[model samples]
Target: MRELKILAVVVSLTLLTYYLVEPFAHSKMHPHVDAPNYNFPQADKVTDAENVEKAKVALEEAEKAGKEKAIKSAKTDLANAEKFEKDTNAFWASAKAAIADKGNVANGEVLVTSNCTACHSIESKGFPPVMDNASAAAAYGVVPPDLGTAGKLYTKDYLVGFIMNPARASKVTHKFVDGRVHPMPGFDWMQPQELADIVAYLESIAPKTMTDKEVFHNACQRCHSIKYGDMQKGTMQAFTPDANIKTYMGKVPPDLSQYIKSRGAKYIHEFVNDPQKHLEGTAMPRVGLTQASEKQVVGYLEKVGDSKKAQREELGPKFLIYLVIFAIFAWLWKSKQWREMH
Candidate 1:
């Protein structure tokens, strides 16, 4: 019994050491080459040129195969861009009607106080104080126009244009010394009434606080206000959304709309469940999902995409695989020790 116990201990230690040493030993192993070359950079450049030509051929073939697909995608982008143009016309019409209505000023006050305070501060009772046009001119050397009498300075069409894309407005005509390109960020995320409220409230504030007060320090104030004071944030494309995720998978990720439209819901459901089936060389990891949860996400995309809902359906298989592997290793270790003991 004593000899058996000692043998079992020795066997267990040997197994544990083998497991730990295997990774380091593998790393140190050398290639059995006739001439060992340490210059990966030179080799990589030569390999890269060959790969580039191959990629060009592949891309041309893909484009040829999906010419209609490419055109459809471009059209979709054009349609979404046009939506903004229509929204602008509707916004101005609403603003003009609201100014004529008696209750509009009151509703505008509520809307402005809630959404505009993050940047603008007009002195309304029980509201955060914003620098009036006069105060702003005194401090910043630029007069911010009062919004209250907007009809006098800007036509209804002009107001609509400004609301739609404030950054694109002309500098000379409006004495909008701040221009449509004023440092003030546009109110894009707000609802239609909320945007109208801001417009209405600005129209009211022009006369009351015409003087400019000093601008406060904000998240972008430090670097932007000092160095790029005169420069506008350009429409430069720095980082594309989901680019990193696509790079990891070694493939160009299709635009969400095109992927869904071409492949159909069932393909997306299976691809999310098991990427290996759709593309053999795809580096995207499988995130296991239940049939029911997959259906829920498919239903959601009919209205809008919800990543959180899809993820909740998918993350289980990875966890299950880890547990299974760990169990198998533990069982093997125990069984080997028991045999040594006998």
Candidate 2:
């Protein structure tokens, strides 16, 4: 009877102690922090001083972080944004006029082959796949017809407009001839001069062809970017950590791996080749490569930029499978210890 009473007393003491001390123990491990109150007249003055000091330190840290991010974002923006064309309208018109000129197509063709044809074949031989009418229509769900007979089929105005905004004119406006959407996107990155030169060359144009993971890396990397956008603009309150690579670019380099894709690469190339080329008053610079180098870079871009789509698509299942496996293992491991403790 005495032993039963003593046990009851011990249990009661434990319950009491737990109720009183458990809160503090939990608080120690995961503290509930709040800003100090400074509402009282005397208390407010003293707390205000401390708050001001803390705020100043925080502001300085934030400013330093901001500057770093701005510089890094500037680098990437400069690289990709440099290619955007100034006046898209002018670009198409000039290209039409230039292609009509005699030496233009020959020179442009030479430039295209020396730079572009290696990774991008003109006619549909077997080697590098051609992004011709049939394939393009099947892939994009619209017809771009064929560039093979672009000179014969399209007027300078039509050709120029098509090249300037392929999506708008080719997909949205025109009838589907080949049962494929045009694969060509806008070249908003070209400078006025570069656009004119390329357009003049394309006037009497022909056909073309195109590659792979290993072969892809070799041909498409130079002018092709796997990343885009200014990393410096967005931040979640100070010290909370930036949610993306752009946030870190101020302190560390930004990763271009996430943004690279066919669509993104095309956009990036345009930006790099021309700054004010898209909008009226843009501020990006041309990297100023020879025609051959530009084409090589574009080819390389097709490989690298295209790879990201496949890679990202694969990540979801992989992450979920791993997470489930980890949770199961954690449960199994903890079960033994729990039983032993009980």
Candidate 3:
């Protein structure tokens, strides 16, 4: 009887924790995340981004009909729908045009050396970072990614915006407010064509196809290590630990293998879009990856971290039913035992 009572207490406490305490804690730590948006939501508003063409058509039709009032109204609607691309935000348009310019690879290489070799390195092309790893960590608080990988991982629009304004592109502008300097400075002065040439140079050196795991590492493993099971070398340590990196980051960046469970897809998406929103002063910069690259990275993380998630979800209900039935039987047994004692 005593043993049964003890079992009942343990079960009750476990049930309470599972049902109540766990949920409350989860609400706090949250999957503060958003659904994947394949279209780069932050791209500059294009003149025809929406169904503004419908309004334009209406305006043309009204002009032909000679309805002055209708034409005027249609014109207003058209204007409202289409926001012309302009400086700072016009990167998408300019990048598209420059890429269409078919990028002079030679010019791009020269531009990259002239403008970028100071802070970044293109190891694929033998451009070592101006400051060695330790010095860069001390100065920038994190080592910059190799531009070669960056070009492959980020889209034209994203790279242009990043070059123009690193803080804005990464969506960590919040952290840059009030005299705090962002590590990456803005190069808004560069012409869109110049930016294009640099990107073109990067693409020229990139392999046409890459594995998803390789994509994730190229995008993340410079700073974050996946100790959960690893996406690198089939071992849990995708990246080696370093004191310089730790001091730069205030700690070793958390292993990413299990963040899919803790942060959730939505949180990860939101985080990639903007890091300062969640962790105000984290050394991790907002990646500002376009929808495609972002999805790839998150998907890779899910693959590594949550392989058994579907299976666990499938079995959850059945296990819960078993626990409830067992609890009911236990309650009845306890009641009968007490009755006999009485």
Candidate 4:
């Protein structure tokens, strides 16, 4: 009994340590999402247009003031803007031509049925009827999303890129706290046309009216919840006399109301793409979401979590101080008890 009591104390302290340090560990492991260095020619044109307008205004003011240096600077800005536009147009034209060819949707359907059905469901009610949350959560740490709504959630280009190489397409490099890499294996062996066909098939079957919240409901609510105001919303079924979720999950999953504030947007994105990377043995599985869908989910998390983060963070130090005080008193009490026993 004494050994058992010591073991219980050790286990309790281990769980306490995990809870206290988890946020700090996550912050250290995955910082804020950094901007990608890759240039987007299409988006640059809008910035160039704004620069051109500013330069024109500067030129007019310089000429009115008879300031040669200011006039020269304005002309330089105008020249740079024109050069950027010219280069951007050329790049955009070439990129469009390279990816101009469309894929066959019929072939894509065949491919999806043959290759993807084992781990994924193409239809909402098909063979191996969309694996239930518990079984899927047990098998892969999370339920695989039905592909029927995927086309609506993702763009054709993003779908193609992800199907070809999930890790490369995601561009996530942060190592998980446990040092596990992404669980997704790349299918780079597939030809471009074949991948394109799969994208087409996905698009063909995707629901057109699926909203961001609906996407979260479909893909995430199974293991996560969002508490807003006074209402709690989630996909998990309510527990009853016969069905206790704790038996399956060990404990109820954490509420995602403040997840973005706790984990950061980049961490969320990386985790969604592959959760095993950030947390080994995590019940959250890779949802195989397109970049757009992932962004939408993260956007929702940020919107809900951003408002109260400052207040929460402000209280963290106070909590730590209280814990220290409590620990000191507890130790003093234990020492006094031993003295009295002697």
Which candidate should be chosen as best, given lDDT against the real structure? 3
Predicted candidate 2 versus true structure: per-residue lDDT over 1-342, tens digit per residue: 574698699989899779878868866654442222211122223433444454555556656777877556555544332222223233434455433444455555555455444334444323343465344334443222323333332344444444455533222322223673334556545444444444555545532322222222322221222343223533112111223212212232223344345235444444433322332232222332223334445555544335355677799899889988997888778787888999
What TM-score would you give candidate 3 relative to the actual structure?
0.60
Tens digit of per-residue lDDT, candidate 1, span 1-342: 675698699979888778876646743552111121112222223333443454555556656777877656555544543453344334444444433433355676777566545444443344443555344434433333323334223333334335544532221122233433344445445555545555555556534311111111111111111221212542212122233323322344443323344555766665654443444335443322224334544453422333344565577787788888997898789889999999
How many angstroms is residue 100 displaced in model 3 relative to the true structure, after the best TM-score fit?
A: 7.3
Least well predicted 10-residue stretch by lDDT in candidate 3: 38-47
**244 in model 2: Cα distance from truth in Å?**
37
Q: Which candidate would rank higher by TM-score, 3 or 4?
A: 3
Per-residue lDDT of model 4, residues 1-342, tens digit only? 574699699989989779877857866866433232122233334544665786788889989999899889888978866775565455444334213448788998898898777777655636464456556555554455567777777555445555654433433322222664444455656766777778778888777666666777666665566765123543333211112334334466677877887777877876776554556455443455667778878877776778666777899999999998997898789888989999
1-342, model 3: which lDDT tens digit per residue? Answer: 787799799989999999999989987876343333323424324322434666778889999999889989989877754543233245444445544455677998998888888888887788876776567776786777778777667776667667777765565554566887777887767776787887788878876766767778778876877776554556544232467667645578777888998878878877776564466557677675657677888888888999887899999999999999998998899899989999
Per-candidate TM-scores read: 0.24, 0.26, 0.60, 0.45
Q: Estimate the TM-score for candidate 4.
A: 0.45
Q: How close is candidate 2 to the true structure, as a TM-score?
A: 0.26
Top candidate when judged by TM-score against the true structure? 3
Cα lDDT, model 1, residue 151: 29
